[model samples]
Each structure stands twice: as C-alpha cells, then as structure tokens.
Target: MTDDRTQDAPVEDQHPQPIDDKVAGILVQEEADLAGHDQAEILEALRQRFADAGIAISEDELLEQSVRIAGADGGDFSDR
Candidate 1:
C-alpha cells in the first residue's frame, strides 16, 4: 500500500536555499520555545536570523520552509 504520509506531505527541497535544514530547524524550535508556537512569530524569527547572517531570503520561501520545519500541532512534520 502507498504510504499516506508521502501522499499528503509537501515535497521538501533536498536542502533549504537560504540556510541548512538543521540550522532552520534549530531556529524554528528556539522561536517556538521562546514565543509559544505562533507561526507568525516563528516566521519573523527565521527571517530576522537569516537577515542578521546576511542571507537573502524571500518571505514566500521562508513561510513554506517554516511549515515544514515547525509543523502544526499533531501535523505530519512533527511525526517525522
């Protein structure tokens, strides 16, 4: 049988464009820990961190990456 998860999950890039996957996850997690899991806050945190590092990233790209990295409560991302 086909895996339901594969069907439902958004295809992720092999590597994040602006930063590393591990680094993105750490940033996402830290923002959540500090700000209580609000998507906007996490996204802003990611945007700011990348900016501070002199990495140019688009808002659309960051939002998409954040969903994969942060995941909603009980969402597919967290399961992985």
Candidate 2:
C-alpha cells in the first residue's frame, strides 16, 4: 500500500539498496518488544534503539503513536 502521507514527498535516491528481509523482521521484533513495556520505558527504549541503528528521532517526535502506543482513553496508535 502506498501511504498518502509520504506519497507526495520526494525521495533522494543517493545509493542503490538491496532488499533485506532480516531488517524487516528486526523492526517487527522491536515493535513487539515495545508492546511489552510501559509507555515511558517503551519510548526510552525506542529512542535508544533508533540511535543505535543510526536513525535520528527525538523523544518529543518519537513519542508519537508510530513508535509507542499511549494508554490514554481508547489509546492512540502511532499509525506508523
């Protein structure tokens, strides 16, 4: 599925990339691990993981549902 949110954005293809299924699995595993932790801990862990992976995502922006699910009311999914 194409995401309308990013569909209109331009991507810089600076390098050739190869498909790696392992990377996809790792991401899924990270989300599963996050699901088992509290909101705060999950966010911290996610931030740390992102840093380790050389991905930049600040706590303020990372706190969004895409990285962690809030336990408020019916809960808000990061829609990531």
Candidate 3:
C-alpha cells in the first residue's frame, strides 16, 4: 500500500530527482573537456565563469585540486 502524500512531497524535502538525459549529456561533455584539457586552463575557465556569475571560490582549494590534476597530466601547478 502507498500513501499519496508521500508521492506528492517536493524533491528537496525528500529524495532528489534523477538527472534527465539532457543533463547527463551536458555532464558527459564537461567531463570530457576536463579530461582532455590542461588543468590550469580548465580551472581558470571555471574561476572566470564563477566570478562573472558573482560567486567566488577559495583559491587555496582550487590550487590544491589544480596541482593534483596537473600532476596526473605530467604537469605541475605548484609553481603557479
């Protein structure tokens, strides 16, 4: 037996909705770009977009991840 109220609950108040096909496609493209590009280039583009959107991210964290990604690509972000 199922309760109708449970089914009517908003997603944020319960489980998140599954990502639709269009969103999945976008995610795939973004991931491919991340993998195929330089880490600093990718990170810089992300920072610029967020800055233009009036959102800010911590430079320390971004540098940390950038270094990790760069190391994986035979490059280094430490000197940056």
Candidate 4:
C-alpha cells in the first residue's frame, strides 16, 4: 500500500489554524475598529487588506468570514 495524499496540495486545502490568544486579541481589536461601520464598508476594507496581503478572496467570501469573526467576538452588527 502507498500513500495517495500529495505533498504539494494547495495551501487552501489545509485546515485553517485554530484561533489562539494572539488571534483572539487581533479579533478584539478588529471588532473595535469595525464598530459602527456598515457591512459594505467593512467588506471593502477587508477585501483591500486581503489584496494587500496577496490573498485572493471574493467579496462574498470575505464578507462571510468577516461576519463569522464578528459573531465570534460577540459583536452587535445591527447598528451598521
């Protein structure tokens, strides 16, 4: 029997890193900064950041991740 998994699989196929203390702190800061911003603005900002970081992400995917992060931070998005 031989292993079938390829060693050169795309990074996207790997599971994302688990959120730790450092990530938690970053999330808190991001949540604070995003407070009072509308969803469209937030999504735009995040998309720009991702592009600057050389990451390719669709607007919808970025928005989904942003909402997930906000929810994890116990944020109230109703205001914006």
Candidate 5:
C-alpha cells in the first residue's frame, strides 16, 4: 500500500510566495495601527499572535524585526 498523505497536502507548500505576500500585506496594513502603542505591549501582542499561528519567535527577534519595519517606513525607533 502507498502512503496517501502527499495527495492531500496543501498547495501552499508548492507555492509559498503568495502566502508570504499576504503576510507582508497584513504587516504593512497593521503598521499604521501600531504607531503610538507601547513598544513592549506591541512586542508581546506580536509574540502572542505568532504563537497562535504556530510560529515561534524570540522577543529579541521581534524587536529587531519591529525596528527594521519601522525604519523601512521612515520611522525612528531608537528611543524605544
């Protein structure tokens, strides 16, 4: 007998670009909404959100990504 799981796998595994694009779109859309929020609160919220999505990311990683995203948007987070 042959394994059948491969036939039931999601197409996303074969085409992950769209999924990545969608995630980026979501982050961009939420960027404005995140402004003025406490940095720690935002980090915790992001950590929880990613955890809920079954993704694991450290606080430092989240902070680094947050700074990078802010910089890309012409914002300064050095004071944080």
Candidate 6:
C-alpha cells in the first residue's frame, strides 16, 4: 500500500514541538502570561520555571535564547 502522509505537512505539524526542546522559547514568547513584566523580571521567573521543569539551562544560555527569540520576533514581547 502507498503511504498516506502528505509531503508538505509532516505529522509533527499536528502536534507541538517536544516541550523540553522549546520550553524556554515558549516561556519567553509573548503568548505566555507574562504581561507588564520587564526583561529582567521575566528572565528571573523563567529561570525558576526552567528549574521547576527539570530543565537545567544556565542563566546565560537562557538569556541568549530569550534574546534570540526576541530578536527573531522583532523584540515584540507585548501580550497578544
């Protein structure tokens, strides 16, 4: 029998990325409930959250990823 999966839309598209791989980015994104919090405050909270989630990312690494994500999204961290 022929495969039914479409080439353009992989199975992963139907699901969220593995949480561990994206936990930091997802947390820093504007979509999270982080309204009105400045960058420093957000990062502190994120550091705690990461530890709580058992993801051992260094503060520098977390800052780097957050900056990267913010830059990629035009630094627009306003609530959606």
RMSD (Å) of each candidate, 1 decimal: 12.8, 12.4, 9.8, 9.6, 7.5, 8.4
* TM-score leaderboard ranking: 5, 2, 1, 6, 4, 3
lDDT of each: 0.58, 0.51, 0.49, 0.56, 0.56, 0.58
> What residue runs in model 5 are displaced by over 4 Å at the alpha carbon?
1-19, 22-26, 67-80
Q: What is the lDDT for 52 in model 6?
A: 67
Task: List, residue by residue over 10-64, the lDDT tens digit for candidate 3.
Answer: 4543755443533333323434445446777766855664465344557875565
Give per-residue CA lDDT, model 6, range 5-67, as digits (tens): 676864655665776656646565532445444666666767777776566777787675555
Off by over 4 Å in 3: 1-32, 67-80
lDDT of 1 at 30: 49
Per-residue error at 75 for model 6, in Å? 12
**lDDT by residue for model 2 (1-80), tens:** 97666544335234434324423443455565555457777666666766765555555766763334434323232334
Which lDDT tens digits does candidate 5 get at residues 1-80? 97766646557556556545644544554455565566666666666667664555567768865654544443432222
lDDT of 1 by residue, 20-56 (tens): 6645655546444533366676777787777765667
Clashing pairs in 5: none
Model 2: clashing residue pairs? Answer: 65-78, 66-78
Off by over 4 Å in 1: 1-36, 72-80
Please give me the total number of clashing residue pairs in predicted model 6. Answer: 0
Best of the two (5, 6) by lDDT: 6
Deviation in angstroms for 3 in model 3? 37
Q: What value does the lDDT take at residue 44 in candidate 1? A: 76
Q: What TM-scores do the predictions have?
A: 0.45, 0.45, 0.38, 0.42, 0.46, 0.44
Clashes of 3: 0
The weakest ten consecutive residues by lDDT in model 6 span 71-80
